[model samples]
Target: MNSSLSIRSFAEYVEQFTSLLIDYSPKLISALIILFVGLYAIRIINRLVRKIMIKRELDPTLSKFLADSLLWALRLLLFVSFISKLGIETSSFVAILGAAGLAIGLSLQGSLSNFAGGMLIILFKPFRVGDTIEAQGVIGTVLEIQIFVTKLITGNNQTIFVPNGILSNGVIINYSMQGNRRADLVFSLSYDTNIKTAKDIVMQVMQNHPKVLKNPAPTVAVKSLTDSAIILAINPWAKNADFGAMASDVLENCKEAFDAAGIVTQPYVRESSKA
Candidate 1:
């Protein structure tokens, strides 16, 4: 009998809680309705902010970021207002929230660094989506630049997510920035091979290739004469879009031309990549 009485007394707060709300029924319901309105208004305002940012020519990534941040901030502010409507003390609530935020920030220091790095990327724009770049020791095609990480697809079919903090600080090589690219090909011939003949052979082959751009002209010069072969540097200017194609064509033509001209080519180890 004594245990039953103790349990009933301990649970009596539920009835009192109901009585308190009933006493302030009008204000309590009004505050809840205000909360709903505030949430709805935040949604509308978020959309409007996005539209305005787009109109003002902000970066698409930054625009979305601003919209999301604003929506959350405004919703929080509205929540405070709604609480105030229900007779809760706003100053005390804000103080508690401030303390909580400090704790959260302390726990997420690394994420904060990444977020700051992402903002820098948006502001400075080292590279964008679809730009072929080498960053953070990874060379790949950029797929997306999100708030915290960058997405990449490597040539070998691997997906990479690089943290913005590391990428923003490291060396980033953007290949597609230049309007035109030059293929830096080193063609080697026998040390005894006629220099003029070798130069003419490389130049003639580059000129004949349809994909090789002619506007900037092609350059062929004897770079050096090594113990094994004569190194001829072939720098051919081509449109950026045709760089790979022209590079591929040059190697094919050079091998054929060397065979036809009876010139000995460089060995495999000394061979340079198709630039």
Candidate 2:
């Protein structure tokens, strides 16, 4: 008698489940169809956006970032629609989603800040790939502009990943923007050295350099008079791409020229010992 009662309960449970399935089957099928259609539409939209970005010649990093963001946003919307189609309450789900999003956002504040910074950088055109910039105490060529960080390669061949948040907020010295750069150099001469003679030598050395700009003309003049020496300022203009090499060449060439001209630099004077 007890086994018969158990069998009857199991059959009743199965009947109830079958009724539920039959009642919801149409909604389930419709939701599935919508999901498939939405996904296909999203793929087409994504492809169209990428093509437009390419046609517009937008930055590759910006294009990829925007594409992925749009794809996920569409997928999220489709998910909400899919569940709502099957008689699920959406308001509570949306609220829970909002709460979860808020929590995630709060936890990833730094990363979000960097992401925003990257967007700002891409929009403002402060610098670009191949630009030589000095920021965050690093001077390097920009290799790639990513969604979170900017890649740079220094003169010493060191690869750096600088966070976009600080880089955008901080002072950025884009050496490549101005097309030209002036190198500020100073040379010391002995008190006995003739100012005019030393100036001529330095000026000639700078003018002879191939990378130095001639139109702006390099300048050599007395900067200051120290107790033991005369300081001469040597300022030269060069193309941005040539600035570093030109400055280095000028310094080296000037030293050799000074030696050939028998120009004496500041003499070392040892301090007297205290009694």
Candidate 3:
């Protein structure tokens, strides 16, 4: 009798298992189909997006990052669709995901902000790699723009990593955006020096420099008169690349020119023994 009872119990278990499989087979098959079709569609969409990015000449780093992010997001949506199609209660799962996302967002607030700022920068392109820019009280050539930070190489050759959040929100002076830059220089002359002669000498030095822009023309005007000396403001325009070199050369050449022309510069007098 015990043997018979065991055989009957085994048969009932097999019957229940078969019944469950039969009831869920169509749903399982439909879910599989949806998964395959969704994957194919995602692949096509990803390829199209990549092509658009390439055509637009977008930053490679930004393009790849966006592509991967989109791919994963699509895959996650597909997963939810597949599970829900199988008659599984997905509200709890979705709530769990939302809660987890909120927690992670709270934990990485700074990083997320930086990421958003980077996206804005990449899209708007206020500055590009190799451009000289001044921001956050640091002036440097942009080395690279990453998702969270931007790398810059200073004039002194020091590397700096500025968070994109601050960089995007701050005032950015892109020296390279405009092809030409104006240099403001001041030279002091003694009261005995002939103003016209000093101005002519400075103008000659600037005009003779190969890098100085000739169209806008350099200007020399008496800026101010102090008790000790007369200040002359010299404004010259040059290509951004040649600005530093041209400014230095013009100053040095002007000094030599002044000496040659017998122009008297203001002499520094020590007020006290300490200097």
Per-prediction TM-score: 0.84, 0.82, 0.73
Which one is best on TM-score? 1
Q: Total clashes, candidate 2? A: 0
Writing each residue's lDDT as its tens digit, candidate 2 over 1-275 gives: 99999999999999999999999999999999999999999999999999999999988777888898899999999999999998899999999999999999999999999998999998887999999999999999999999899999999999999999998999999999988999999888887688888899998898888898997889998999877778899999999888889999998998888889888765534468999
Candidate 2, overall lDDT? 0.91
Candidate 2 is scored at a TM of: 0.82
Model 3 off-target regions past 4 Å?
Answer: 1-52, 59-65, 74-91, 266-275
Q: Write the per-residue lDDT of candidate 3 for residues 1-275, one digit (tens) a residue.
A: 99999999999999999999999999999999999999999999999999999999988767877997899999999999999999988999999999999999999999999999998898899998889999999999999889899999998899999999999999999999988899999998888888888898888888889999997889999999887788999999999899999999988998898888877775534356765
Error of 1 at 78 (Å): 2.3
Q: What are the candidates' C-alpha RMSDs?
A: 5.5, 3.3, 5.2
Model 1: per-residue lDDT, tens digit, 131-235? 778877788888877889988999798999999888888889988777788889987777668888888888899889887878789989989867677888998
lDDT of 3 at 109: 99
Per-model CA lDDT versus the true structure: 0.85, 0.91, 0.91
